[model samples]
Target chain A: MNNYWSAIVNNLDPYVPGEQTKLSNVIKLNTNENPYGPSYKVLDAIKNSCNNQLRLYPDPESISLRDQIASLYNLNIDNIFVGNGSDEVLAQSFLAFFQKEKPIIFPDITYSFYKTYCQLFNIAYKTIPLDEYFNIKISDYLPKIHKNYIGGIIFPNPNAPTGINLELTDVEKIISSNKNIVVVIDEAYVDFGSTSAVSLINKYDNLLIVQTFSKSRSLAGLRIGFAIGNKNLINGLIRVKNSFNSYPVDKLASIGAIAAFQDIDYFNFTCNSIIKLRNNLINDMINLGFEVLPSKANFIFAKHNKYDAKIIYEKLKDNNILVRHFNKDRINQYLRISIGIEEHLSQLIYILNKIVNN
Target chain B: MNNYWSAIVNNLDPYVPGEQTKLSNVIKLNTNENPYGPSYKVLDAIKNSCNNQLRLYPDPESISLRDQIASLYNLNIDNIFVGNGSDEVLAQSFLAFFQKEKPIIFPDITYSFYKTYCQLFNIAYKTIPLDEYFNIKISDYLPKIHKNYIGGIIFPNPNAPTGINLELTDVEKIISSNKNIVVVIDEAYVDFGSTSAVSLINKYDNLLIVQTFSKSRSLAGLRIGFAIGNKNLINGLIRVKNSFNSYPVDKLASIGAIAAFQDIDYFNFTCNSIIKLRNNLINDMINLGFEVLPSKANFIFAKHNKYDAKIIYEKLKDNNILVRHFNKDRINQYLRISIGIEEHLSQLIYILNKIVNN
Candidate 1:
């Protein structure tokens, strides 16, 4: 440990995102990024933005991008807030709503970043155990059970490393349980599989929905994410964001994200293609003696009882295919694989055939 | 106030950056951005990076960009860290170094964001008053005044709003005084005027130097910034950054920053031109009955004794020009104007002649 680090720094267990390899020709199915490039309109907008105006700072409020998102969601711009990415938005949300007198609650098997954010903000947290099927139990999250030690709750829908989703009715149940306390629903994977909580925002003032352009919009490189909530919740996020960095989204990012939202046809085509491919991939994996979870996300969580997950991960890496394998006790046997293009999935099957069928 | 806001969010006084208008023809001069576009190489690199790989996550460590910066300063890659912008880097430094039991010190009139950061981090700070001549009195920072309440120190070189700079020897004096605590020297404007204390990073473990590409490199649209310091300090920042967001620098930002550094000749040419234009503008302002600071930066802080600064700001806005006028005391009478191209400045002078010389 470094002697100069603050107590907060010493306490932080930094979040480790899935590996992003620099090698060319590797079939990437680790991080759940869309396998397709953004729309031509997005590329054109970004290229057009590369001018002398590159010298000027981007809009701190992200007014244009926020307005575009709000219009798409049938909400007011006051109900929206944009940031560098959903990770940045998620981090800001932890600072804004989750750091409270009582310990916050989240799913133990959800996005690992929740724990990291709690450490960085010095907020106490309790992780309610995910059910045996890797599902969230809404009843277990009631404030009465914790006797007022409940500050708030946050969990990603179509949860990472599990690829299971909570229905809108169940999500609303949790929000309704914590009326006074805030409830954040991270929708990073929502576009691929489920209905957004945007409709629930107007009804529940305590509901905050965080989404990203990184997955479905395929603009991860541009780094844009946003939050949709009531005006007061939006204002709290704005305060935390402005205090952190005024211009988190650069000029090109703002323009590029706005263009992504406008290209509805292209976005729909790519997302649907991933869903079809995901279904086919799951069938193929099950045929190969692996048990795959029912997934609505662009990824699947699968395990084969006969094969060691670590060994398969290593063999795949050696063969130029990368997938995520968590080493934790409960998840060590499972592999979280992102859905790639048709060609990428075919290549992955070919590699698995050589390794597993043997 | 919002009831859901955290104690920190409730306590925040968020920073307000300069206006970013969507108009096509305004002579923008409020934010201190470079008037020139980035080199052709930077543009080509960004275009080349706009491929299907945009779906993949950017390298969280920002290895290539950090390597280039480290080599420029003759330091190890471990000694460097990069972020979305210098604002992000500066914000992280506050969380990394200045959040301690002792109070930090900065000039009362330095970059306004320092105070905002303090409020957000809940760090106690004491602002040392700048002398009547609008200069940083380095000796006033002597540790003898406050026994151990000094957590660290930070101020912009060629200090903001006033555009006055401190010599290298004087900067060393402050660093020497705060030997035990981390001292951050923001060099956001150093490329335009003063020497960077980067070289002193090796001699003193407590010194951290922060710089940004937003100004001199003319890549504000890309949002790239960095810090060079002792390995431990850089490590501390990495922990805080990773805990917050894994990939602060996006893919295009990484590639564009590397291209900007490689085109040394183009970077030098633009910086020199801006310096020359700043000199000419200062002379012109003095001729027009305005008292201007002796500036080594790309901006000049000036006041016309006969005119109100706020009125001038409003008049310029009506005339489709924008310059910054802080409504705070002691500096409310002055205007901070970014040095635009010769055409922009000439047009500004023409408008001022109509308004002031009338």
Candidate 2:
């Protein structure tokens, strides 16, 4: 509210990230982080990079790391754009391709940051509501559904909070219909079970797929994320990035993420473990009379038949367990629980059974 | 050139940072990186942080690192704002404070990124030409100098490339006269030899001081920087940062920076060594019949009286050495050479002597 602030600052509705509590021994299943640590190889690589060469600036282009990501996706380095994190990459995308004379569109109940970005960039937006079953309807995004123009479209595959993944076919339909505009597929949780939209990149020049090392790769602390898109689309992001921060990815982060991409066995093992744990947790919640969404992410969205969602969330917190409960419309009774280790989930289910019965 | 890019992207002339060549055995002094590495303690802290905890997201507010920086300046945590690098901080500052009714003003030949930011944010600006001696004249920044409106002011102290430090009293005079507008003093190279405007934070709420770990603290590869200012201005930056990237500083970066701030003795020793080396290098350049600016930074800006600046730059590159040369209108003749180790400088002088004589 300072007078010195720009008018945009006063209007900015900043994004509130999930709680990152530092309390020790808490079952922290709130942020959907991977239960397992990143590959031990990543640690070794980071440790090896901690040398005198740190006196110099990291590569502004992050060429080697981009090359690694390119190899994984069978894309060229020019198709990739890396940043401090996926959040930063998203911000750049909004400025790069979304702002226009017409408003952009997304799921009404998708990642809240999309709306926040709209406010920050003064881009007009309309949120099309999800279907009654909490699924993204490709029909809702058809151009004929709206009379006014649409500048772009963006939604997370295997969406957050609900964790329901839209099939790859629907993703392509949206991209094809929005050929005149940029269609961003935010695949932050894609590695758990959902298919990637990256395969369609060559077919649709306007398709941009953004992913992160935070979820399946388990490198949230290193803060690495990237976008895979057409070379021209990537160049647009690069222009905005070069205008902003020349070196968004630091040396250690680049090295750590490169190692994460290199260890295919470890990556597959960890993602499979999370998917297995997620299924087990879903089954346990269903047995306790909770109705759960069909989740493709590492987290589950569920509501109890008897107990109040907020009360259950509090009880879990009181018992030194943490899960996310969004106090928002149409989803107030649902709790988003991230999958933890087998032992932690066992304790969670045991505690939930007592809370629900009582 | 893409139609999808935001209208601002087309007008943006992005800043071209010095080349980060991958060539080996080159005496790299192009960027003002410290000749020495970060303290051993910093490396140890970073290595220790490479563990399982990296599975979780870093603290979005970066409380611990902010505390360390606040303690260094005898200020509160509310007065400090940390970001990916000084460049990011500078970019945030442009969006947060400078996009006002009137055009902001800076030196025509200052850090070129300032102009790039003005273009990126679509903020109007006027660049006051430096005096014939290449020093930032405080009078030109005085409110009376321009009949039209002035939005704000930002300039690098020990101004970039030229490396001439403006007196603290002059900095205060500009800040005082421009009380209606925010004044930013970028002190990226302040630790080398110049006094910090941090001493003046309490005196003026509109004064914001930006500093970085790249040059003096020897952590360019780590990408840590901070801004010290009034609580309200800091709040403004927080709003913009939260809207953009909630956690610009990653986990390992935060821990590594805290360690760098803790080892004050190492910081001072490295800074003093660079200052001593800079003085010797200046004297050597003067002996070689080159005119050098009165530098107060880790880099020296010099031009030979007879030799063409671009040829010298290329010759040095050919000799397995790298230095910066801007081909802009005013400073085209100057070669900005970073202060490297004694051996690197001796070789520089020997080669320059031969290049000039031969």
Q: Which candidate gets the maximum TM-score versus the true structure?
A: 2
Alpha-carbon interface RMSD for all candidates, in angstroms: 1.0, 0.7
Task: Please state the error at residue A47 of candidate 1 in Å.
Answer: 1.2
Reproduced native contacts, each prediction: 0.81, 0.84
Worst 10 residues of 1 chain A by lDDT: A141-150
Highest DockQ: give the candidate number: 2
lDDT of 1 by residue, A84-148 (tens): 89999999999999888899998888889999989988889999888898888877877667665
Tens digit of lDDT per residue, candidate 2, span B1-358?
A: 7887878887789988888988878999999999999999999999999998999999999999999999989999999999999999999999999989999999988898998898888899999999999988888888678653898999999999899999999999999998889999999999988989999999899999999988888999989899999999999999999999888999998999999999999999999999999999999999998999999999999999998899999999999999999999988999999999999999999999899988
Worst 10 residues of 2 chain B by lDDT: B140-149
Candidate 2 scores an iRMS of 0.7
- Residue by residue across B31-59, what tens digits does model 1's lDDT show? 99899988989888988887777777888
Query: Which stretches of model 1 miss by more than 4 angstroms?
Result: none
